[model samples]
Target: MSQAAYIRDMMSDPASDLATGPSEVSSFYSNLNVLLTGGNGFLGRLLIERILRSCSGVNTLFLLLRAKKGKSSEDRFEELFDDVIFDRLKREKPGFAQKVRLIEGDVGQIGLGLAPEQRELLRATNVVIHGAATVRFDETLRTATNINVRGTKEMLRLAKEMPNLKAFVHISTAYSNCVREFIDEKFYPPPIDSDKLLNLVEILDDAPLQHLTPVLLGKYPNTYAFSKAVAEDVIRRNDHRLPVCVVRPSIVIATSKEPVAGWINNVYGATGIVVGAAVGLLRTLHCDPDMIADLIPADYVINNVIVAAWDLAEARNSNINNADSSKNPEIDEPPIYNVVSSCQKPITWGKFMQQIEDFGLQIPSMLCIWYYCFKLNKYEWVHKMYAIFLHLLPALIVDSVARIVGREPMLWKAYKKIHKFSAVISYFATQQWRFNNNGVLRLSAKLSPADQNQFELNMDKFSWSEYNYHFIRGLRVYIVKDPLHTGPKAVVRYARLRLAHYTLISVLCGIIFWLLWTLVRFMGI
Candidate 1:
């Protein structure tokens, strides 16, 4: 049965037991103090917004932010609230911003760059949410290791100093163990000893390290995944015995419903492609149309994160109470939850593309360069040919015309960059992943009814059509920064571009046919 149908059946069947729900989950965070890293990031911002708006029992969120652009971390904290996300909070939950306090620090630094007083203050934190890491797939091994591997080690060290630390929720990716086809909610052995790799990365120079990268990343696809896999190992291998749980969420998109329905702030991950395609710049993608697009909403991910923190903390408390009477100590292991859509409402790439295209036509972007039409091809060579003929050829012509007319030539550069980026992401798009999210379902079932509704993470109840429509609208408004009033102009431009595309194809075919006929007559064959 489809996950959606299974969930529906579970909800309707009164005969089945739902008593595994969280008996004491609801008010676990009353007067709870939190120490959160990655305050200025995309997910960081959403998590903060959700906590302030929804997690009412929470006391304060002490964010660790690095000072940048000559601004103090405290000064830069103001910039975070200036986002449209906080706009809703500022009006509806007027004083919720008061719950947030910024501490000057960098995860990459010694002791997380925390000052003595800051460290002392953070010692009072009962819960630690480690959401900080460089998530780019193409990041260097040295860089990814420092932040993902070493940084996590530093956070665990800091967690030890926290006299009251109950739960440590580390944000990981579902693809960390992606080398395997069917991933269970368990940690695989590290590819290499993390400590050895860390030392080697520190000692090796740049050029040599670059040369050694492929050798180091053997079975792993990229440095990001390798580092994350090793980071998970770091946590699993930790001797600190601290309460820990890793939340692995897949392809996080805009909010389905939360601070605002379909609210997105950045153009990272799939957001770039969504916005790029909506603005009519992206035309072809090298991806399998049948592969499952394991997308989970940012808000849903956040909701699960919050509840997971509560549940994990409760489990640790139970362990403490049963410490003396322990039945084999229950594996001293931190539970991992795979927050993905595949185990729930699985949507194929073909369906996802159709939804995006349908909505793109309905709510056209003002900044569109062409019609919102795109092809998803499984063949890499076909995509390459399309890139050359359809993408670069037109781009070169446009850029050449601009150069001739004394305008800054840019279209060719844009296409080159676009194709390069498409190449980078195509690896994942063509591959199918079957993530086992039994852990996620078990987590949800563990939640009390009231807590379940308040912090719902179930994708079975989600409607994709409505979500896609609002998401495109949100992309237009928030990410594209385009006005709704410009829709009419965008539609006209789409029509013009479509006409130009057809005319160009016709002209090229006619020229080829004419040349062939002339050659045949000249030969007298």
Candidate 2:
């Protein structure tokens, strides 16, 4: 069959025998008590909301939270409700707050550092979704590993004790093995043994460990990726009797389609590119415009997680009677779903950039760019040279001006920090990695049409133009949370600023070039 026919068949509603009935949703829900670590975070928040909305039969959602000074878990939960992210949930389910129970806990400590009551709640839960981890690209290894690797181990330990546990879904990154050119739905052990890295961090002080991070992570681009890879390894090694699923999503960006279009709450991933471009701070980025960006929406990832949990539970239950065989399936053979876009259909980075630019122009007359240029200057060596120059020159100049003017240089510091972050991420920007998603395809093949629509990440159905509009809105409202940028006033201000800056830079470069040419002529060349 042609790939199109195959996909259509795969997406077609399953036969009644294969379909999950209402009772299944109820069973998934009543048996569906969930322990969600980092439930307040961007992806976590979306996942929680999605489950609550779509899986209304869900009995309870135990949100693991750390107790803050002078504030109770109840207070934290209340604050979360106040945010607009939960507004839709409140409207849809008036009493939905009752289903959410915040368990006082911290993931970085043993047993999730839960209290006796919280521990009891966790033990009684049927599913555990581990989504808590540091996403900062330049985070310290000590900090990243603590929450990413150690926290995962602690969660697994907790899951192992749950008598009625069905599925343990660990949220990981598609870039977990980014050092490799081709990634498949398979476990690639961490560059360093997880235990060894944990032990080394424990022995070394923060300063020493920070210095050694480069050596420790080696070819891994950043602490986030390195630590997540280790965490996945830990999960694979410690699978002991629990059905687990590893979800590796690539560069999760704004929502392509969901509860709301272009719904993005975090500024970490490709949202940074949109924000930088919209504000004109990023005039030139050293990236292969033609390469696939491999971005999946946050909601799409959450949907996959839910479906994976259901499928894993059903599959495990089916194999329960066959568990005693000498040839039991590989313990490490737990499904590793590459929740990425490269396989379904590829979207080029250049097209994405163009869409954003077009979206930016549609804001208003005041926000329109007089003229803009995107010169495709590709050089084998100059990309790195430009990266270094762009990263440092702005900060150096800004800092120098600040000192001369007797003013604090906040922009320079922000620039320096972002530059460091870009240095780590630029490697991926400059190259593309192919992920073999045969597993994702196989998983999709088994899903009912209703389930497939609910859990879809088909890039072939993605509309970049519409996505870019939401992308810009999501960046402004959700990521930046800048009221000024949401309306026309901000658009006017941005346009004036862009024109001023462009003129200044153009004049300066023109004068410098003219002076150099005159000098060459004076030298009698």
For each of the candidates, the C-alpha root-mean-square deviation to the true structure, in angstroms, is 5.9, 6.5
Superposed Cα deviation of residue 176, candidate 1 (Å): 0.9
Instruction: Write down the TM-score of every candidate.
Output: 0.91, 0.86
Most accurate candidate by TM-score: 1
State model 2's lDDT: 0.73
Compute the lDDT of residue 76 as modeled in candidate 1. Answer: 81
Point out where model 1 deviates above 4 Å. Answer: 1-26, 69-71, 323-325, 328-331, 508-525
Q: Write the per-residue lDDT of candidate 1 for residues 125-236, one digit (tens) a residue.
A: 9889999998887898888988999889999999998888888999999889888888777788888888998899889998999899999888788898899999999899
C-alpha-based local distance difference test score of model 1: 0.80
Model 1 has a clash total of 1
lDDT of 2 by residue, 244-282 (tens): 989999988876655566666666756776666565444
Candidate 2, pairs of clashing residues: 29-32
- Top candidate (lDDT): 1
